[model samples]
Target: MNAISSYLGSDHTRCDDFFIQAETNVSNGAWEQAEVSLAQFTEALERHFTMEEKVMFPEFEQATGSSAGPTAVMRMEHQQLRSIVALMRDALAARDAESYLGHSETLNTMMQQHNMKEESILYLMADRVLSGRQEEIISAMTSIDAPA
Candidate 1:
């Protein structure tokens, strides 16, 4: 089994792949494909966020006893990401490739920074502080219900 950083970092990569696929579809002027790809990307991203918010962050905070630290900042960042996602969705619905690309650029930058912090610091801390419970935590994260 992978460590928390490995597991969640892999997820970050997965979501990035989906985002890139959507962006490529948009750049190709394939609006139909872009819509489908964007939907997939949005769903995957939402699931990742839910896994963190409902399972990983809570468990990390419980183990570390630091509610207002990294997890809090992460939660706030999640909200920001979600807002951008909403705008992207609107752009997709309107078939506005330019607007979608703009939002995608913003999301890409934000995700890169957010993921660096999580992978380098927060996830590493969780790996150490919640060492013995790694399996339990990872199991919970994997089994979390995807957001509807």
Candidate 2:
């Protein structure tokens, strides 16, 4: 299997599952559980994004002898995500279910968009540009822990 299919699939699966758990907690009005679940959800995102920004993206950029395209956009999206994520903590603290759900949906959309781009375009590019680090990239991501 290609790196995109072979690697990112598992990570995305777990992360998405966590997102659903967080959503459930919020839907049930379990603010405390939702808070913790959100934290765990964020951790999973951080772990995956960190691995990409630190390792895979750089390597792909280097391999292609350029760094001004897809990776840049991904970085920008990450910033947008962080901004929304910050608001989540406050919403959670206030037990503002509406606000919390809105933020969670925003985060979910961001992740879905980001993942779609990464898996469809970025990972394919990496599969082409990166020569020898397919397994390494995958392993790095796999080893990184989600929040809880």
Candidate 3:
């Protein structure tokens, strides 16, 4: 609504909220609730990543003509995050609390660093380069056809 940074950062917060709910449930040994929360978190997080990979990142890259730049780094980080998510999912399925906690800690740390880069640098860059096309970008991001 306010631009790329506000819109995407708010989504980051939303995903974080879902992560927190799942983490809390896991900590409480509430497997059922944790499963539900984690599923929601994974879905939302994947959606956010898809929006960036499919729409926002390409738009930013084309506008700036910097393929091997911040977007590339972000893409790499997304893959790493996805791998970590898979590990977490495995841990959840196995009911391995220790593994889940360890992976979750790694995830939290990675997300903090990754998000700082985006919210501070990449999003600002997008907002600057892709100026006036914010609404279209947001619409694409929100669209069902944007990505998974």
Q: Which ranking of candidates, highest TM-score first?
A: 1, 3, 2
Q: Model 1, 1-148: lDDT tens per residue?
A: 5699999999999999989999999889898998888888888999999989998999999987889999999999999999999998898889888999999999999999999999999999989988988888899989986678
Tens-place lDDT digits, model 2, residues 49-120: 787787787878888887899999999998898788888878888888799789888888888888888888
Q: lDDT tens digits, residues 1-148, model 3?
A: 5699999999999999999999999999999999999999999898999989999999998998889999999999999999999999999999998999999999999999999999999999999999999999999998834234
Tell how far residue 45 is off in model 1, in angstroms: 0.7
| Location of the lowest summed lDDT over 10 successive residues in candidate 1 | 139-148
State residue 79's C-alpha deviation in candidate 2, in Å: 1.2
**Candidate 1: stretches off by over 4 Å:** none
Candidate 3 Cα errors over 4 Å, as ranges: 145-148
Indicate the residue-level lDDT of 112 in model 1.
96
Window of ten residues with lowest summed lDDT in model 3: 139-148
The TM-score values for the models, in the order shown, are 0.97, 0.88, 0.96
Specify the highest-lDDT model's number: 3
All models: lDDT?
0.92, 0.79, 0.93
